[model samples]
Target: MQVDSDPDWSALLIRVRDHEDKAAFALLFRHFAPRIKAFLRKSGASDTLAEECAQEVMATVWHKAHLFDPSRASVATWVFTIARNRRIDALRKARRPEPEDLPWGPEAEPEQSEALELRQETARLGEALRQLPEKQRALIERAYFGDLSHTEIADETGLPLGTIKSRIRLALERLRHQMS
Candidate 1:
């Protein structure tokens, strides 16, 4: 019997779940890596950084392929979202002493996950983040999550300092607009 070719990405993910399927992995990597690179570039990553970030995203996909769920999002969307979150994480690492990460003795504040609905609300927040123009989203993610100062951000990103602030200001305004 002849085998069908160019199966859906969801099916490719199923193949990736098989422990020995290196070919499935290569196919998945080839398809998604360019999209990841384009995504990072649009989100204001320099070319070199975009390339490096795409590699990381694909590495993640290879490792996490078992976790792929068609119900959550299309394979492409899942991959891009991972890249987006990674970019934000890279852009905005914590600064100074984080309240939670503080090495306080035994009295540290206990942590808990947000409830299911609240987590969905935060997912809505993510969708809202995606709605903002790419530049605005990138700036806000970098500032809020990466905790970079305006000066440091500008120097690292090569964006004019004023543009950075404006994009962040606009992104926040958009978030409030969408959330309320």
Candidate 2:
């Protein structure tokens, strides 16, 4: 009967880096995959995601094994550090919010054609109001832009209430026809 000897992880990593050793990689995978998976799951990942991330961490180890420094950390420390960083990156990606699509908001832009039509209609209404008699223009301005009730306009202008209402009505009818 052959006795099983514990393999050196640092030597296995060096073999994988220098010689692309499959047996060394298999040894590393067998030793570390389950531990990495457990670490990820304990840190809040689902089992399926933990499995996938463990596979990625091992692939990184295979490619970057040459970067390991034995003086600074043991093979297990290096591998587990990589696994922890990968878990942080995955959590950040999962938690990020997607961008909002915004024609539905309160500040949404009007269509170009509709905006242009409103501008032209406003210009026409302004020209129609300018063409009115100055007395009528004054009464309309006081009632609408000046925010005055008929009684207020009459008090301000020393005009009869009936005269103020009639002038404003006629001015609005002219503006409607011109705009239409």
Candidate 3:
């Protein structure tokens, strides 16, 4: 079959979203799966790990296609983002500490005052995060909670690496000021 080098991805995503169109999904899978696999491999995942992550990413796209927002991100960016998140999650799970063989023990609890202070600090940080600009907050969340590198963020956001770094740096400075 002849392939359109520049297919209209937004249209395909709409089809996937509105009608659960398998043909549109097939087109997306054909185009993005190998790219996602390559991206995972470049990030240091093994071939088998990359393949599994790529499959999971595509499956997520099929299931979550309705969540796609073309105004916010192109289809490739969205797919790569899913792939990136999946890879990070897989790595985190693989690195989880193994449970010890010893029997469970009742560990000492923290002091009530210390626990209250920690909770207060968490609340403050949450408020500060809420006060940030939408773009800034999104960058912060993607970098910290999403575990995406600057390069990956740039790719997914379709921004320059320098822009991503600068925004993150400025956002961090603002957060520090707000916290203080």
Highest lDDT against the true fold, candidate: 3
Give the lDDT of residue 7 in candidate 1.
43
Question: Per-residue lDDT tens digits of candidate 3, residues 1-180?
Answer: 112335767678879999999999999989999988877776668899989888989999989987775544567667867776686677765433435745534644334455334445545676788989999988887775445788988998899999999988899999899778
Against the true structure, candidate 3 has what lDDT? Answer: 0.75
The 10-residue segment of model 3 with minimum total lDDT is 109-118
22 Cα displacement, candidate 2 (Å): 0.9
Q: Compute each candidate's TM-score over C-alphas.
A: 0.48, 0.48, 0.50
Comparing 2 and 3 on lDDT, the stronger one: 3
What is the C-alpha lDDT profile of model 1 across 1-180, one tens digit per residue?
Answer: 011233466667768776747787788888889877876776567899889988998888878887665544557667866786777765555333323633445633222232223334445676788789988877776764343678889999999998888888888888999878
lDDT of each: 0.70, 0.73, 0.75
In model 2, residue pairs whose N, Cα or C atoms come closer than 3 Å (at least 3 residues apart or on different chains), thus clashing, are none
Give the per-residue Cα lDDT of candidate 3 at 72: 48
- Estimate the lDDT of model 1: 0.70
Off by over 4 Å in 3: 1-5, 94-180
| Greater-lDDT candidate between 1 and 3 | 3
lDDT of 2 by residue, 1-180 (tens): 001233557668879988999999999999999998887776668899989999999999999887765544557778977886787688556433335733444544335455434434444565787888888897765553343568977897898999888888888888777767
Worst 10 residues of 1 by lDDT: 107-116
